[model samples]
Target: MSGAHGRRERPPAPEPLPAPTVDAHTHLDACGCEDAADVVAAMDRAAAVGVTRAVTIADDLAAARWAVQAAHWDERVTAAVALHPTRTAAVPEEWFAEIERLAGDPRVVAVGETGLDYYWDHSPPAAQQEWFRRHIDLAKRIGKPLMIHDRDAHEDVLRILREEGPPETVVFHCFSGDAAMARECAAAGYVLSFAGPVTFRNARDLQEAAVVVPEEQLLVETDAPFLTPHPHRGRANEPYCLPWTVRGLAALRGVTDERLATSARRNAERIFGLADVPPAAHPWTGGTDGARSA
Candidate 1:
């Protein structure tokens, strides 16, 4: 059904998982959420369906600030701050300083959604690389996981990570590589976060790669407000829809949904330092769908 202003409504929520997991990457701000209450409702929606924890990511300076605030708004939410590659065309030195400041916050768990994006020509390649290096350094300095967003620039992203000496915990968010690339990343001790696209019928290569990834290195995400999973591909995505991706991945890997979800949750907790976070109350009566359009 259409929402207000004739926007496409979100798909109905998938069934809750047998075990809880974390959305390693998402953007609550992009989901049209703007305040603490909105963030809480979104978290509750996700929590209701066993996505008990989440790490919302920032794609630009404004988002970086918003992410940290969102983290504070809900204990279930954590933040990853960065200036996205596509937005690096004209970034000033001060912007990096601000990102550094945000990264220092206790609420910020990772430094990223950073790396190369060759798909969009919005930013010059040189500038994207320059800032990518800066974010890498910041992640290393802060002793946090480095979350990377590698679009059509896989070679360069890998090369730079090798050259710079990646952080102890590196993650390729929404990993888009095939089996060969997945092996390379796994061998390097980097985590591969698979988002909704893995469930698409045309994504045989991704499914193949997902099978090759070690259970400990695998993670699942919604990339909410985008990349809605199969059977709901064209609709607005939200965290509650994450179970579809998890179930699809579990089937591909020939594991029980509980086992896959457990491993993914452990990997996220270990990487993002969420090991100490207490579980949110599981009030199953809430809307299975995520926060609705206002």
Candidate 2:
């Protein structure tokens, strides 16, 4: 029998699987994987593990473009654009305009992954502060949420947020500070997002922070391609591993996994404008189980 074009060439790579929980934060550009294809495959793996949504952040224009394009390929994925604290000095004046342009795109849901990182000091403190303020302003002007990244610069970050008066939805992604800081952020009505480090034995302070954060203001993330949890420690982190972080937070808060997971999902949807996210179902009972019994 004759065949059309040698058997239709095997139908390209199947679309990547979808995730169960929303990963609120991640850096697809930093996974150290070879290229976009590798990153997409990683995301697919994450989806298979139940990570239903993810916010892929970019620290610069090129990376932001990559994030935007990545979202185009996956419905559950979205993008966040801004100059990271360390890279702030290198950004051109027109970068703000570019960010504004990107923010207007529906896929670009948040204004940052931006804030202070005094721990590294990769850029001058002043430059980092200036850029951070710019991102906050941009977020406000665009009426979108802001994803903040603070490291050893909490005082200034808080001060700036107060002075600038951040928009309604603000998120502290990869929140690693003490309980006091968590309380302060929560008091200000900002969402606190925990990452893989929350599962570490030595992360007692982070555990404390997790316990005290209000349920409605709490979130969980992978921060992947980095901060892999304990069992997978030192390995390249990925979104599929978010359950470890979520379980860790649940243990810390003395709440059932179902309660913690539902709270985290609700918080993520509220802050990220993803209210359309369906209720999470327990794996064992399939869809009939609904959320885990509290």
Candidate 3:
């Protein structure tokens, strides 16, 4: 019924808490939801299941701004800003300045979700290469890590990163390559972030990749609202379900869930520049002298 000024009043509720699991990477700007309310609801659902910190990424200028704002809404959320490789053609030259400006913000931690995607080829190869190099330059200049999105173009991506864009910390998110490639990436000092695909029955190669990657170089992510792990297959994935992926990795690596989880957390914090994380509170610091439990 209409109340004062003919308006319907809403009931009060308690403030929502953050998730427990740490979602290493997610595309908050591309969640395909309507408005900020939808985004918060999605985050709440993730938190309910134990997912905690999330690194929400933005693939372009507008999305970058939205990501920054979203991070402001929750202390548990951080942001990564850069142009997606596929959208390189759409990114104007002047937008680089805006990216640079955003990259300087404290909330913006990494400089990507940018790299090569030969599978789709949404943007011209040359243009993608140029933009990718520019992003690397900016990351290097600002001393931030680079979050790479390489899909079916591993060789090219590796070559470019090795030649012109050697970021201090390079993270290959949703890594789908094989064991050899994983070894090479690890040897190159790049962090390999595994997603739900690693738990797929048919993803033996990806499983192998997870096994060979050293604990220090391994990180786990949901890539959520997408890439839901096995049992939850075909469903809209959320960060809260990362434990499934972590469990899968644990099995493949011959380590306990707590052990793998701790290592992954430490690796994420190290690569993501989350040094402010307290030593005792860090999951990997539970036992021993900085060595992760196997």
Each candidate structure's count of clashing pairs:
0, 8, 9
- The candidate maximizing TM-score is 1
Candidate 2 lDDT for residue 55: 84
Task: Please write out the lDDT profile of model 2 over residues 1-294, one tens digit for every residue.
Answer: 012311222222222323246788887656643344444566667766667778888877777766766565556677898888989877777877887787777777798889999999679999998899888888988888899989898899999999998888899989989999999988999999999888899988988988899899988888876788776777666677787787778888998776777777767777777664233221122223222110
For model 2, state the Cα shift of residue 288 in Å. Answer: 38
Decide which is better by lDDT, 1 or 2.
1
Off by over 4 Å in 3: 1-21, 32-40, 275-294
Candidate 1, residues 73-110, lDDT tens digits: the string is: 67889889999999999998898899999898887889
Ranking by TM-score: 1, 2, 3
Q: What is the per-residue lDDT of model 3 for residues 134-185, given as tens digits with 9 covering 90 to 100?
A: 9899999998889999988999999998899497899999998999999999
Q: Each model's C-alpha lDDT?
A: 0.87, 0.75, 0.75
Better of 2 and 3 by TM-score: 2
Candidate 2 stretches with Cα past 4 Å from truth are: 1-19, 32-40, 275-294
